[model samples]
Target chain A: MEFKNVTVVKKANIYFDGKVVSYTVKFEDGTTKTLGCMQVGDYTFNTGAAEVMEFLSGELSVELPNQKEPLIIHSQATFEVPANSSFTLHVKSIADYCCSYAK
Target chain B: MEFKNVTVVKKANIYFDGKVVSYTVKFEDGTTKTLGCMQVGDYTFNTGAAEVMEFLSGELSVELPNQKEPLIIHSQATFEVPANSSFTLHVKSIADYCCSYAK
Candidate 1:
């Protein structure tokens, strides 16, 4: 009998903060990473490599208190599975979730 | 008001897996990541950089049902604050939290 199977993979969270600007990005293969420069607001600055293979990419919403402006996050990724195809994800968090920027 | 100020930083999670063998490591700065070659068991293989600055290092317990062997996680980190001081942390999870090695 022919059969089909499905599986889901999970990952770990690497929190980062700079108080200047930052970013965190994920991949479809479940490999998540983040990196960037924070601005005047308090935000998590995930420390990821400057370069990676081809993978999934998307945006993340960050909400912090006293944040006059929304933090812009950019994550570019590539995966080992894909021979070449790649993309980028840009998400601007509301700063509500991470309110460390509250003054 | 001549007061003291203290703050805490949080991080995000990124799930990863390989199946032959795996590992996950975290730093005091809230930077958590995982990597390794999975064996015959299943565990979350968080994809982190092969190298990091200096920071906090610790152990994690992973307990997965049907997991006969315990997964070993090693994370070595350094910090940008420190000039050079650094160390390493190795954790052996009971395979309970992220149990996917059941085959």
Candidate 2:
């Protein structure tokens, strides 16, 4: 589902030479999410909590450490990353996404 | 300066058929700013307060009601809008911007 009734936190965290940028949003049920954009590049990210990422625009090729083949996610698609794991995202274009974190 | 110490709001407010998207950022001094992206289009916006808009990427042609010619702003450039006034932005590409509001 799209975010229609969430409170956006008022801070921005930029990473990797300004290639990836995102903001935090708080849900009514105390869960938090991140919405941001990524430029064309390959990025490695380590997650402490499990995350479900929803793509809003562009395309992404994701490589999980445990998977043999890379997963291709297009616009309006969703992917998940396990907790305490690292994943790599291969961005072909400027991608916009929303990430929901599990509590 | 780019956003580093700001807090991102957890909600998103979409406008104009999702042509423009942005999230709010709160500052340490209690000031608020907005960071977002705009697709290629012509958009007219009315503001209740004064705003300084900084272009992060792409190009923008802005026309204020009092100005005779449109102002061309490039990436990393900034433009200001007066309170209670309206302005039009002619977007050539997907433009990223950061807007700080005067309170």
Which candidate has the highest lDDT of all? 2
**Each prediction's number of clashing residue pairs:** 58, 17
lDDT of 1 by residue, A19-94 (tens): 2222223333444333222212333323123333221222343332335554334443322212232222223321
DockQ each: 0.03, 0.12
Tens digits of per-residue lDDT, candidate 2, A1-103, equal: 3444556543355677556767777766888888987777899999999999888776789998689999898766888899999999999877778898998
In candidate 2, residue B33 scores what lDDT? 81
Encode model 2's per-residue lDDT on B15-49: one tens digit a residue: 66556768777767878888877777899999998
Output DockQ, candidate 1.
0.03
The TM-score obtained by chain A of candidate 2 when compared with the true chain A:
0.90
Go through the candidates in order and give each one's C-alpha lDDT. 0.27, 0.77
Estimate the TM-score of every prediction. Answer: 0.20, 0.59
Model 1 score (lDDT): 0.27
DockQ of candidate 2 is 0.12
